[model samples]
Target chain A: MNESSLPFFARGMDPGPSFVDVLRRLAPHGVAGSGAPDHGSALIDTVHGTTVVAIRFASGVIMAGDRRATSGMSIASRRIEKVFAADDFSGIGIAGAAGPAVELVKLFQVQLEHYEKIEGEGLSLDGKANQLGGMVRANLPAAMQGLVVVPLFAGYDERRGIGRVFSYDVTGGKYEEADFQTNGSGGVHARNWIKATWRDDMTRDEAIDLALRSLFAAADEDAATGGPDLVRRIFPTVAVIDTDGFTSVSDDEIATRAEALLGGREEGAGL
Target chain B: MTMPFYVSPEQVMKDRADYARKGIARGRSLVAISATDGIVIVAENPSRTLYKISEIYDRIAFAGVGKYNEFEMLRIAGVRQADVKGYSFAREDVNARALANAYAQTLGQIFTHEMKPYEVEILVAQLGETPDDDELFHILYDGTVMDEEGFTVLGGLSEQVHESLGATYKPPIDRATAVRLGAAALTPADQAPLNAGALEVAYLDRARARRAFQRLKGPELDAVLAG
Candidate 1:
């Protein structure tokens, strides 16, 4: 953003491969918390996205998120996408303050790419998670102003040849989730559903179905979490990160799955 | 005190320019050709770990042919500039012209003010929606920037390679043909032919989503050349 000069730093003073570090050196107050709202005074009812979940299957990881952003008791939006591909092999799911959450995802994506280009190789899975952690830590000032952002990170680790998921706290503490992880207002309900149905050797289709079902269950319990809106044909956004790469499940397919899921529930309720 | 001899500014500049040119002339050459899909870049480099071409942004790519360290520094700076700009504004806002101008300013400043000029000749290529919109910028060590059409060459053998490439290149070429042409042009007349392993190839594919730059190596490189 600084006018047209190449960002060449002196020896030992370089930001290395970190894009955030470069931002700090060039413009100390450029990124997060720049113009954050004051902490007190009945914090603004900014839009808040909710309920994103990640489940690890045999081959890789599948992340799914409901399409809802609630401002106080009102639905601010019905098609807010929470799940995003962090890179070719990884994905991110966001929750909390909608504005800052989306911004964090954008910044995080740039961070991964920036490091990859500068270092001539991508960061290790663990390293990517830690990098996101540091970014979350940087957002602490903004988080305190009632714009807390908690994100779930999942990726297919090339070295380990398995899917990995990481969850973070507001304080930037990162924890690896072995089987699965869920976050946001409906996180508990979704996690409960996943814990009941998830298995070690589930196929890709099974994993995707389980992810959709978990979001459905969360939506049933949490008002902020949106269920499949058949009238609008809006379904939860889903993405799978595998050895091949990150691929999003198409909306048409998700719509069919949502319809089938509801039909099965209807039959069970009748029974 | 002993009298100190003074050197004229013009002579000093000429000396610096010559030194930089000599340093650049010792390195291998690189070529970028515009094709239907994107711009293909081929460099005659044997070192697997070191890269002469790399992605700068979603659509922009940076390539340098000269002293590896000096060019590498320039490459990293270009990445930083493009990334920072994309972060601040929209990705589409970052363009080759702006990046080329920035590089020119930096090199010019160093050449005019510093004790020594950087021994690097760089290329910043941006893939356009159509073949005609594609842009190639060739920048010199002394901060001169040339907006090239169709194809551009960099490094010590640029004049010869450029001429050879111009003879064979045709517009709207496909990826495979572009790679072959670039490779053919990079090989000097007196030297033995370069194999796949001895060359580093990459392209900025407009058809690709998001980051468009991709490297051609190993089996892929072999396949393209063989084709």
Candidate 2:
């Protein structure tokens, strides 16, 4: 398609601020929920991602997701990324149907950038969360057809001078989590681990460790969630979003942490 | 039934062009200069909130001088177009030439067919990897597109401003020098020097990542102008 030209109107009827609204008006199908058709048959064989966790700490928020995609009883992909930067200061971790989940993240990223450029300012953290909720609501039709996409959004709230986390239901209901949130096939195990280890005033390092431990526990019990692969050098994606903005933790750091976790487990087994 | 008066097509075209030019000429002028770092645009806009320079895409920027509502409408349209195109194809595909052509088409169509032509002149600038690759397209109210080099000016008294810019136009200048030159050219002969507060500055610095457009205001603008 050609580049979009300026949209014209008589006067005062402009599609103000929202890029999604503009897309909805210009190309209805381009908007996420407006195009996906509902199917009768279940999409049971689709690639589904497991285990993603977000923890709010003293400085900001830590988002981590295991690098695995599963279809029914078999592994579909082992190095699938599930954590994405929604904007400079915000990120989203996906934990549901892999295809739709990735698409949702991409669309959300574009939506945020689009709004910022059009309005000449970034949206508030709350506004962004609500916007994600709206996108999820729009995906309800596909969600009903078993192509659900559930995401956890975390951002550093400039107004409040603190990090905030929001989790969404399949129907697009948003709930602001107080400390930490987790989702996916291994969500139960990961959530339990976080509940026992989470703290209100954890440091950045402690938050990262807790997230890694939670994912490790999830992978241990759930077949869909893959643990850190030493041979393949594949590790979970971990990102920190704070006042300085979103930055992905290096693979070496993650590997070192995973190795330490495994060494501790080995010591426990010996005992 | 009374017959409508026969107006010659030349007369009608001239009238529309004249009307559009008058509307545009009422606004203050702006200029875009290709610099060593990237492209620098300086406009004589005092209002901080109402911008005349904005990003259109990753490497493309849009600048306009004319009716506020009219140019702003064009700006939003350009944003929508670039975003949608980038979304559909790859990001690199959304360039200034394509956007310039699109603007020309829209403006030209409106100028010829509509009862009231849009009173706006716009610039679509794309900063390339090197100084040689930078593109500057100056589009007119009647959809005339000029692929400019070194520097281009827009809005009222553009001829005088263009001459001023042409006299001092030099390639591969630094950011500060480009801003100073543009500010000098924008200032009228009889008027005092335009201060930082009276100017709006933005640039597509190649050193910047993906989105290259940036605004220089307040102290930063002052620093650049002082240099």
Candidate 3:
């Protein structure tokens, strides 16, 4: 709160438009650091679970994540949110260690806003993806301690006039996926499901259905992932980013889609 | 070593104030007015890249005149302060009042203690949910703070601009009218009206979500001026 009280000379040596750098210089511990001891031995004891998928379509991109966080054989949280708005035109979905993943998302959000505020313009989509890569790289220390966080970043690239998807490794290696990407415990299942159904030039409805079906398939096979809970009305979080901006799908719509999918599965079993 | 001749405290302060004032007077003027929906800032700046008005937070905006380097430093400091505060606390808690006070403290300290005072005049404007809550804090070169309602002008020829603005300014003005009024005030009586390209305009619209600060430029600026 009293950040302005820093000496005039120090203020003059501003870290030049990077909020993360400024935080690192002023509050070193706040930015991801390497001091924490490794928890690799008991990694399963900590909260870990996810199935987040991002698919690029004709208009833009669709990002969806199931609401589940588990520790070992126990469910830690049932309605945990994993998808967040990176900015107006971008979205991020996290999977891996819940605590560190959420922290990384918060930091990424701040970094983008900070850059925009200081530079008087938002960074290009490429610049934003690269920035996230740097943050993930910095979090390498935490990742080595079994607190790995892999996030899926998707956004409507205004300059390129299309939606783009970028996935990352534990050490901040960024890979631009041509079609779709998935992360978390059930990522493999979700990825296979998406590969079978995904098609270029798909409409928004088809893309949404594909995202929901992939998440459903992941939840069906992966014990850590949670499926839609009809009694509790908990559905996967889905966000659509396109030319207009980023908008999250409503829970009612998701429920409707989940019900239809369930009905089709029942009929197929009977047949 | 001979003893240095002692200058009176009042004389030293006066000299510093005069020096600061002269540096400020060499620059063009800027204005901020409370509009029907939010706050609008207009500056007679020809450079498209060098901004004189900018956003400091979601609801707060900053405008500076006098020295570009000095004011830009202040602008960046304000942004840092706001961002840090919002990060530490809630975003709603980052208001203009605290930022203006911080600027005053720094400018005042430098004016009296530093070898050379900073030559800058800055305004911190926060758009409230309602027109009655809008605030315009004008901080002068010597760290003098003025909490003005309705409108305020800063920099060289401020008195003339103030008079022109006061004569035409009315509460609850629309965005286009506010821009025209500010443009008229910044223009000298003998000179023709300024075109959109020569002016820098920004607004903190209350209706805007989260971040309210937006620049009006190119065709948007031309359209507003034409309107």
Candidate 4:
């Protein structure tokens, strides 16, 4: 709060390049997750986001998430974006409690940008994953109260010239996936779908189609997940992270693909 | 009992100003010019790792001349202040004027209270939607700030650089011309013009989306210099 003095930390108390640490130091209560729970049986049916998937291909990684949030078997939001670019090189797809999950994504974005500005370079892919792990671990108290948030991180590691994917548990346990990973109420279904079709040499277009199909399969089985809505003209959000950088696939392209895929399914069912 | 000689307030202030000026005069010069694309900053720095110009916020940039360690410390502090403010409030609320005032207050306090004043002069530039909206603030070691127009220069040889830059001080020029003008102004009259390898260049490109600050180095720097 003191604007005159420089925000210099003592050698022992320095936060270094961690922006989350700076926030924690400034406002201890704000970054401690939502609030204290009453520890009662009556659970809060907070809005929950569902079904995000990431797949690695030859050139880079493609991430996709449904635009649906659920609250006690009802649709809370039909157009909620769950996947976001953490920085230029990495993409993050979040699931679980919508409020805390979105907040965590915002914080993660600022953390990466802040560290890059202060340190004059971005963190390594592994370093960024570890930073997100620490943040998820810090949210343990809220996660215990049924407000869990698990995010899947994927990036094009320029150093190794390969795309990598990482997934996290509620307790902040991080695990690197070899090819693809998924999370949310329909994670298992989507993972099964991707596991069957995912190949090591998948092209960008193939990976994108596979991701959309997996989300479609998940939505068919899970009430929380929403499928592509043709009436509303709403399609799943998709993004690609490559050596060039992170880019969102346009809605027009995704809509076309969704229609084509749906037409094939409709014809097969008619038989 | 040892009795200290009482010095006049004016004399003490004058001596501190002179000392600070001498220290600043020993460093290489830096120039910043407002252009059509963005604001270009060029410094006669050979070291690639140690930056003389840096980003402070989404649309703001900071450049300093004088003691490297002192300016580097100030650069880091400015970044912290800007980042913290942006995080606490909305990103649009963070501006160059507030940051410049903070730097002034700190420098003024040190100039009067500390035994020795910091030997650094800094520039804070903010990119606007239009060329006329661009803001550049030049802050001296004694905490005096000047609202510069179009372009500003800092360092021991600022007077010479200013004169050289003024001859071709046209607003809304292209980025390459702005860089060339800045590099020309920073170079001494008797010496050959500086090349990309010996200069550090950066700009707050208005064409960018959020964070506008970008450094020009290696092949990119060479291409710009050639342009």
Instruction: Flag regions of model 2 displaced more than 4 Å.
Output: A1-6, A9-14, A34-39, A265-271, B1-4
Point out where model 3 deviates above 4 Å.
Answer: A1-13, A38-44, A267-271, B1-3
Highest lDDT against the true fold, candidate: 1
TM match of model 1 to true structure: 0.96
> Candidate 4: where is the Cα deviation over 4 Å?
A2-6, A32-42, A267-271
Give the whole-model CA lDDT for all candidates, comma-separated.
Answer: 0.90, 0.89, 0.88, 0.89
DockQ of each: 0.79, 0.56, 0.43, 0.60
The DockQ assigned to candidate 2 is: 0.56
| lDDT: worst 10-residue window of model 4 chain B | B80-89
| lDDT for position A210 in model 2 | 89
Model 1 agreement with the true structure over A1-271: per-residue lDDT tens digits: 4566888888899899988888877765658756665656426699999999999999999999999999999999999999999999999999999888888899889999999999999999999999889888888888887889999999999999999999999999999998899999999999999999889999888999999999988888899999888888889999989999999999988888877878987653511
Descending-DockQ candidate ranking? 1, 4, 2, 3
| lDDT of each residue in B89-139, candidate 1, tens digit only | 788888999999999999999999998899999999999999899999999
Reference-based TM-score of each model: 0.96, 0.95, 0.94, 0.97
Q: Is candidate 1 or candidate 3 better by lDDT?
A: 1
Clashes of 4: 0
B198-220: candidate 2 lDDT, tens digit per residue = 89999998998888989999998
Residue B201 in model 1: lDDT: 94
Point out the higher-scoring one by lDDT: 1 or 4: 1
For model 2, residues A1-271, the per-residue Cα lDDT tens digits are 3343456544566677777767776667777766566568565599999999999999999999999999998899999999999998999999888888887887898889899998999999999999999999989998888888999999999999899999999999999999999999898899999999788899999999889988988888898999878899898999999999999999999999878877887643511
